[model samples]
Target chain A: MYITWMLAEGHTYKQMLPTTPGVFMGEMIVVTVVGADKPGIVAAISSVLAEAKANIVDISMTVLRGFFSMIMVVDISGAVTDLTDLRDRLERKGDEVGVKVMVLHEDVFRYMQKI
Target chain B: MTKYDASELAEIIEMLSFQHLDIRAVTMGINITGALRYDDLGEGVREIVEKHARGLRDAVKEVSSKLGVQIVTKRVAVTPVSVLLDAKAGDLNEAVRLGVSVAEALDSAAADLGVDYVGGYAAFVESGYSLGDRGVMESIPEALSSTERVTAMVNAASTLSGINMDAVYEMGSIVKETANLTGGRGCTRLGVFANAPEGTPFVPGAYHGRGEEDPVINVAVSGPGVIENVVRSLEDADLRTLHDAMKRAAFKVTRLGELVGREVANRLGVKFGSVDLSLAPSPAVGDSVADVLRAMGVEEPGAPGSVLALAVLTDAVKKGGAMATSSVGGLSGAFIPVSEDLGMAEAVRKGSLTLSSLEAMAAVCSTGLDMIVLPGDVEEHVIAAIIGDVMALGIVLDKSLGVRLIPVPGAREGDEVDFGGLLGKAPVMPVGRFSSKALVMRGGVVPPTVSRLMKG
Candidate 1:
């Protein structure tokens, strides 16, 4: 743990550890990938998020007869990139990989499914 | 512990992105009854703008951002202005001027607050027009045409009051005059209703009724595509199984409404009014009530089994929605607006859905003749007769119904016109070029039916 100072406006100012540049942070979001069944779909999706410094917390993928479907819960709080930027970049990557990608905040899932 | 798991998350994402699950509108109904007590109209308008406009845009933005679900429309429904104009004389010129001025004030306030539509520039005359009702009625055309955001309605009939043919006849000409003024666009802002409710969040039919004494939040839920997808998946579902499937789907949709609506109201410090579980459609392919009807065995929306399918769909939705939330009001059924629903538009293009068929469908569903564009040459009296026929249906069956017909200028039958955006693109449907001049000319109030007398 690093020393942190509390500011008047309720924001934290943290001093960095000697070796690490960015602190470990997480923001849970659901990502859905759907397209024709093919190889390298997972790698194609993960590479874009990974390049943006997003962490894949959980993932599931399956092929239904011919079409492929993948769902991932990722943490992007550690990324320097904004959520909107990462979403657009991932969508562009999906277009190249011949799949449809959708990224939504995890609250949508929690609100709809549980209660 | 968090509420949803992996499977539920995937399902929600699919419905949201592809199946068109969304919150249609969060209409905040504010009571402007006290405004009438003020001597000056400007003072009244000032008080209203002050009370309602503050922190509205910020509240909506904050709630929408916090929830992550899009609150697509923000609207305000004020108490009917006709009540305020009642103390004045029924002079037509004065009425129009007052209408335009009041509308300008409301429109400016709404624009300032970043609200989309300001409803309840309306008058109710189910039996006969009061002096103020007459004043507001005569000014509706000028009022609606002059304002950008203010929408209005006239309840020409109700279950107890029966059909007011006199008011219906007047509205027909008002509709025609409004269409002329705005090139068939202003009519979109007007709604003529039978048995209109006080809590409908959707416009132009929404108004803060006399029954409501305080501010309230009404939520209109959207998701025809999700139910359509579910119905399509169950290819072999019988009527019983289909009903069950729809109930289950509606339950989920309305639950989302309840959750989001209550949170929004709580954040805004207003009372949570109701979750109107209407499967409202937009121009998008997947977000169509007609598509849901198609999935329920109707090859076309106005075909033989269309009414039955609509009945089943409407009943199942009401049941599910009622169970999901304690307070459910408004037109809580599937909307069959031609331009708004892609499937319905296609049905019109294929020549399967006719104007008469739409009237028949409206008898079972929520609104009548909504977003249907007619040829430019259609007679004004014929338009009134169309409304008259629908009003008659409402009187007999005792259900809420309305008409939002647009007689496009210079457009003939089968010629497509694009209003663009959520108003969508629509092909002009034929209105048969018939004249109802004599019927409209002899307009007297249609007396209450035997059903009205039977209420013991």
Candidate 2:
């Protein structure tokens, strides 16, 4: 039940990273969220994704140690702007809500895989 | 005669085609010796099983979670319980009691840790036997009938030890009886083998091998979703393009698994086993090995569904894993654990799938007759035949595969084994009612054939 709440609150995601070395066909992005419990965490972040023209492919969310943790898989093939701008905007919102948000290129996963 | 047949000079024209996966589990080793801890005369066996199950659950979760992927199962295969229960083997009732305790401990541990399936309740007697081995094998019917989570395996022969004809003869009857007693779950819970490995992490076939120490870290990676996505992504791409795409994704999946695995191993301080990038499936709405097939534009996953899919998927995964790390092994193909897969389970529940259908899937999969939930009270001889069929395939194909049949207690046709979490809960399927007792009883030795030498 609380899992529902954390998911509802913002979550983490991978923005479609630009297809670079060690990456697959599509642009991939990963987003991660860690913070004190709150509501609409996902709604808030997904709204940002909507603004950035990304599609969600997979998602996982949970609450641990009274902190909300979530991971989102997104496609930025259709994004209107680069993720850096989006990352800046998300950090601003996260700071306002006292939530910690991180936006990573999907290559981070690719980078991780190479090791 | 055509050169292809007579002279054998015709080059084998191979074409890369469909790319999809159906099987999701490649658990190769599960040590069951936890039940034999004799510090207090085996008083700590249950605790050990509990610890083993919990540790596996925790480790599987820690690694999978770190990778941002949903692991389909957190299973453990242990050493056979019979060798350790020699003192208690004579009493079937006592053997059953211990089996029940271990099952309960596993279930309880999984429940507490919020992980899924915990296996490793078995006995192996491929060559000689012990009092405990006989006891555990005898109690299989009752033990399997009573447990919701436990899995079992019996090795009657192997390359190391010549086939135990006597043990094979008895096992045939026992398999059928277990099927009958458990209403057929035993058909899926039971597995017989010639040369079973020591570190298998999957079940119905997992038993402690001599090399296993305490418990070690092993990772089974499933990417049917990834595979399916790749197949769809390359619909218009040529075979080379499709294979390339698969290789690229497989590389990422395996890399992610390696990263997570190394971390878990470092934390546990145990040597890490291979990263099995088996395209495992889930029972979720859209997750299935069959779904993978459908994505390849094949309406069904059957004979003539294109035999090349297996080789293609295998090659792609190997390339990816190779780039990820130098160390890799285990049943690293597509998994098709029947009851554990949502699509197959649902198909069985709907009556569109059958045992032969499973066998067809097994031909190209990592293992055969996996986690198949069957009706209770199935005949044991039938179970023996199922095991024999898979064992024969293993010998003939020279590939590693085993059966993990579950004879759900109190279950009948249409009943479900609700083992929530990674095992995903599956409905029981029906098997042939006729007994294979005569054939099983005639078991001399399934002499190892040259097929067993397949290095692939």
Candidate 3:
């Protein structure tokens, strides 16, 4: 169950706070969310990641041909949960909000993309 | 700072999931020339084993975990065993035994360290055969047959020294003898090169040259399938657009290679060598340089426009790869190895790609007659002539080229030979029935080109 709240910027977010503290420090994961173009999707995803103390190091989101897509490199060093556990929490939020979420180690994106 | 938006991110995902994009090989070049002086050969082998044991294992673990990508094949290339034969002092039989023992030790050590292949069981006789070169040359047949992972190469031709037809002829016979000894398996591990590079990271040809550092890390990045997908998506795009897009793709691929290579080198405390951007293909369907060529509007590889297409593709890849990394080396061009490339194999199977056309492509591309399977009845002289022809191209163009032909014993023309995995499969193609016995039997070196002598 997700509780919704509105910010001063006229954006809505879900409350999915981290349940634990300091779970694998100095690690990162790449998160990608893709689904129908809709409001509150970014807010929902960011809220979940922030609640888990995952710092977004890099992010690129764009809507193409009426479909919403986003890719974020998040430092999960201070995460309160294991990577897969955090991914599971994000997936639940994704399910509730009607989007697809994929979580993988940041190295995957780094190996395929950056130098 | 490297921001990949939706489309670019999708491209990476799709390439990895469907197109089979991955690092082909991360070959570590180790200089074992210093190992030759030990009274007991076992001491040299132990030194090699100890040096590589922790370094390679730790790097592989950390890189795979941190980068979240497979390193694919872990390989080792050492100094050519021909140089080590100096210790044997003109004893051919004793050198052969020593070569076998050294190769077995190296192979066992490599296997123990979880390496895929160990190269540099080689003879460098581009000008003329030295005693040590001859010893290693004679031992190649047994050495390769006796070991699982040892790769051998013979540099029988180079631009400066011209073609050593004498060594070339012997290599042809040695190739046949190796096949006979190992039932065509050994020939796959042996390559004949002209102008072989000092920093090559790819197998059957890579060796720790005398000029290189004590130990270095070289990475070979491959993504023929990725390039194919990118090219195919732009249907009816102009040639310039196609070339530009392919360049962009290669730049990204090579960047990733440089990143991984540097990180691995830093962790292992060895200098980073080069990122080889050869579009090496596998047996898989979409992962072929021929597929990329086909996407460039060639109906089939080895067709009339195929050579030009390959030239453009090879040049564009180099331009992109050059911009991506400073230390780019090895055979950095599109490879049309027949057996290893699915589309090339299909082209051969359909009778669209012929031996002559493949040679023509090799003239413009990197290696020549790579992984081509020929009929068992093909004479030794004919094979020598084939190597001579490719060597002449490398000699004239002053570029690196190699030939890896497997004459499948008992297989006739149109017969299929399967070596499995990266060795892939090829259909035995017919060579000219005519023999060049007299020419090969000349057993003399072709002098350096006039251009070579003119270099003051």
Candidate 4:
């Protein structure tokens, strides 16, 4: 266990509860990564999800000049690991690989009114 | 126990850990009013009890198991018990009994299905009043308190008839009383409507109108963050460019709604309703409709300059939404629902906006008269006047429009009501010091007399 103090509320903090049984299992969600282009980026991240035993439902990649971006929607209900830990690992891996990765909850994406 | 173990679970977890999606809600509509007997209103209610449980029983159980997704909300929508009065006007006793009947049916349905709520105990008096309307309205406070999962609405006024001030006066107090009913739970389940559209899919408010037989489906597509991101990405985009971007964004978003809706219908075995391609904004961060307009260059969203901003955005949004879905029907366009939207409410609270500016926006947007909060003590005639403005717009444009106004008790203009959460906080916007007695006093039914549109 860790005890820590942090600066607060002006920033929105969303607390994700454990997805209920029979609801979130095998759920699918889309993720996107955008940042300066670098080598071995896709391999580094895909391998992380692969190691976590997540299913890659769909994926697309593009190299926008000096920056590289990729969008992937994955199903991870059957994953061998906890989702929170996987998220932490991905953030660290992103730091390692030089590309910023952001995960989006699919249903949240749906409810959001597009401009 | 952990919901899943390794093997398929771990890999799936890893992939979804950084993945994205949300499930808005799962709603069920059950009709219970018919269960009331010709004279035995109570047993007629008992029949409704059996019907909703038996009819929807297998559907809910089967869908939940197969979808492998927990249904977010299990609700019921029933025939408006308010209509019970047409034949039983003298039966205030029966009206009260009927309301109790429907409430018990809702209670039993929720208990049976383990669903949170049921809807469609509603009254639609768009143009004129019926004795049943009055009876139902009178009993709603009692009905709301007595029921579980039984949500209700009264379409007290509409765009065509201007507005019924008497209905306004009654509803104003009724909602206040209803909110106090059952420790505020009733407030969560109730909605008061004006210029209500005929067939909307979501509720506490959805009803299968008597005139509609097709089981029409209308999809409410939402994605404020997506649109905000799109608009944000276009920093220097001109209005034309903005429209183009939104159109492209809408096309992409509509494709998503179409996919899910068709799948839901396929599984449920129902005909598809029109996908309402409304950019219904919510209170989530970065998911604001007003932010898009602000991003469009109206830094102060409620200022005089913003009216033009709204006009341009409303028109451009329609242009995009029309291009996205062929079945762009229902109240389609951007929703400026104050209580439901984060940015608009914030703008009002900060004095960046006013009711006048909101009404101006509605003139060109989809929801002609929408979720605006007026101050308490504003006369019924003033409310009627606003409704008149909305109805005029609807008649002139030949579109479906509605209003969901809340007059918070004891709140005045420049004061704010904290609804908390996604209902957001509302700033009581100013309604002009004016009256429409002359216009409203001349109240006759505005017949369905669209000469050219009817010709087609």
- Each candidate's DockQ: 0.19, 0.07, 0.24, 0.05
Off by over 4 Å in 3: A1-28, A33-70, A80-115, B1-4
Cα distance off (Å), candidate 2, residue B386:
2.4
Q: Model 4 over residues B56-130: C-alpha lDDT tens digits?
A: 445544443332222333344445666655654576675666566656655665677665555566776666676
Looking at candidate 2 chain B, the ten consecutive residues that score lowest on lDDT are B8-17
Q: TM-score, chain B only, every model?
A: 0.96, 0.75, 0.97, 0.76
RMSD to the true structure for each prediction, in A, is 6.5, 12.0, 5.1, 10.5
Candidates sorted by lDDT, best first: 3, 1, 2, 4
DockQ of 3: 0.24
* Superior candidate under DockQ, 1 versus 4: 1
Decreasing TM-score order of the candidates: 3, 1, 4, 2
| lDDT, candidate 1, B1-456, per-residue tens | 243444566667667766878888888888876766676664676477658656667777666654456778888888877876775445766665666677777888888788899898888899888766776788877887778889989999998988888888888788888888888888788889998998999999888987763688888988999899889989997999999988888888988888777877788788889888888899998899989999988998889989999999998888888787888889888799999889999999999999989988997888777999988777778888999998998889888899999887788999998888778988999987566789877888888778898885
lDDT of 4 at B78: 49
Q: Show the colliding residue pairs in model 1.
A: none
lDDT of 3 by residue, B1-456 (tens): 244455666666566556777778888888776676677674686486558644786686667555545567888888888788766555877777778788888888887788888889888788887777888888888888888998999998988999999999988899899988888889999999999998788889899888877788888887898899889889989989989999988887787788788888989888899999887888888889999988999999978999989998999899889988899988898888999998999999999998889889999898778999988767788889889989989888888999998888888999999999988998998786677789888978887787697776
Clashes of each: 0, 77, 1, 51
Q: lDDT at A10 for candidate 4?
A: 15
Model 1 stretches astray by more than 4 angstroms: A1-111, B2-5, B37-43, B88-92, B433-436
TM-score of 3: 0.87
List candidate 2 segments past 4 Å from native: A1-115, B1-39, B46-77, B87-117, B145-148, B157-194, B345-353, B371-378, B406-438, B451-456
lDDT value for model 2: 0.59
